[model samples]
Target: MKTYYKDFLIRDWQPGDRNPAAETISTVLAEYSIIFEPRGADIDVLEIETYYQETGGEFWVIEQEGKVVGTSGYYPVKRGEKSVEIRKMYLLPDVRGNGLGRYLLKELENAIANRGFQEIWIETASVLKEAVNLYERSGYQPTTGIETKRCDRIYIKKI
Candidate 1:
């Protein structure tokens, strides 16, 4: 299924979207001076459905003028668990501050909620201030005890 938001088209990830999605992520990471590591292996967006679909998770891409410009998804933190981790949400610089992030987030949240997920967890780096702000504004609260060297900030929301 595809959703239209102004000139942007949001839809499930397709086979050809992987490269553009990876480029979008790479550009964002480089812009923020962050290095891509094994933890960021999901940059290979084409394989997202392979890893997430069996677990009732999904990967979405946003296109403008037929080019992939944004990506987001969620996956089970553990097999058969009610909790899922939001992953790989990135938008091109030109599209920021226009409410697309919130839109994509709501879509993902609703999809997971319908699939019986009870909680959403997200981890982001301090450098990505806008992302942290977006999550906080969307009702995610800071949670302690979870640690990751790649991402220092962790937030969770119970749905």
Candidate 2:
């Protein structure tokens, strides 16, 4: 297995990443539930992927030395509208301490902004304090949560 020690690359998710991407999502959801019980494994993986594939969402991944370290996504909030939402951002446990989280956020933000979206919104969990901090530090502000079965603490950032 490849180990990432220093530099990382953020790029659009491609067909080659599907299996590793699915594994990463499954692993992160399982790990996240250990801290806060939310986002069922099936929902985060299968359901979310079905939704993404249907809606033409763009997915991204962070790779280091041929290993997938993180994943994120950008999709239309509402079709024909200039709004978008960020989804399923995750980083492996070993890579969590470094600044890769913020780096991925900025990279995704820039990618979506370039597509003409005026703003981006993300819904995390109230218990995921580290995620919340990263969002706030990256210019996201708390917003009223959307009524969905998914557990979320919604935040939005204007691009």
Candidate 3:
């Protein structure tokens, strides 16, 4: 992992990061009884390059002393003209409430804006209360047409 996202030791994802990132997402979702669907909505976690980087998108891994504690990324989508969908942003339970999620979302927006994207979209389940609050507080307006089965809410923010 290469450090480039401020002072938090956040960096782009790598193939070696697959397992730890998956574990972090799984652990976070399991807290709310959400299943980690490797073959469905989460397949992008396992194929970061294909779903993200390969299509003008990017993925990042949050590191704590060389351990993957979180994951964040976005992929270009067909909505809002020059829009991208924010996906796979999950942090270990211990890392919550420390402003990491807010920071990550900000940095992700910066990265997205720097890439010349116009808007950012997100789909999340209601059970992830923290995530739902983060998105709403960060100026992501709730929208319709949720594409993910597990996600009951859809939000969009113009960058």
Candidate 4:
């Protein structure tokens, strides 16, 4: 509901938080899938856990009064490009429209840019108008390349 920015206390997601994060992700995915299918709709919990376990990717959680309201993460891409694919960006329903989404987007961009990534890419269903707008406003423009089987808007921002 309420939103504000503080120092982003982020680190690699631990094994203990994997299930909770997966639970949270499942809820969001189910909720959103009603309108637009997520890119990786067939992903299993074990696969999700393994991604966190193996990639050593950054999974950031936003805390307000010590409660996790939102999360964002990135995974490495192929060589030469040296890109990071932003994934699993979700904010609770009650936390929407209060500026937290924009805040989180900025945090992710800053984190990725600092890690020496050349650009960031994201895929979301076109039905998610808010997400498309957020990406555009955050300097991401529509891109030609999208690898999803489903129809999803693709956006990229140069770091």
User: How accurate locally, in lDDT, is each candidate?
Assistant: 0.82, 0.71, 0.88, 0.65
RMSD of 3: 1.7
Q: Count the backbone clashes (under 3 Å) in each candidate.
A: 0, 0, 0, 0
| Model 4 deviation from the true structure expressed as Cα RMSD, one decimal place | 4.3
Superposed on all Cα atoms, the candidates' RMSDs to the truth, in angstroms, are 2.1, 4.4, 1.7, 4.3
- Which 10 consecutive residues of model 2 have the lowest summed lDDT? 34-43
lDDT per residue (tens digit) for residues 85-130 in model 1: 8988999899998899998899889888998898899989889988
lDDT of 2 by residue, 75-127 (tens): 77762348788887888888897887886777778778887888787877766
Which is the winner by lDDT between candidate 1 and candidate 2? Answer: 1
What does candidate 1 score on TM?
Answer: 0.90
What is the Å distance of residue 125 in model 4 from its true position? 0.5
Worst 10 residues of 1 by lDDT: 37-46
C-alpha TM-score for every candidate: 0.90, 0.78, 0.94, 0.77
Off by over 4 Å in 2: 1-6, 34-56, 79-81
**Considering TM-score, which of the candidate structures 1 and 4 is the better prediction for this target?**
1
What are the runs in model 1 whose C-alpha is more than 4 Å off? 38-46, 79-81, 145-147
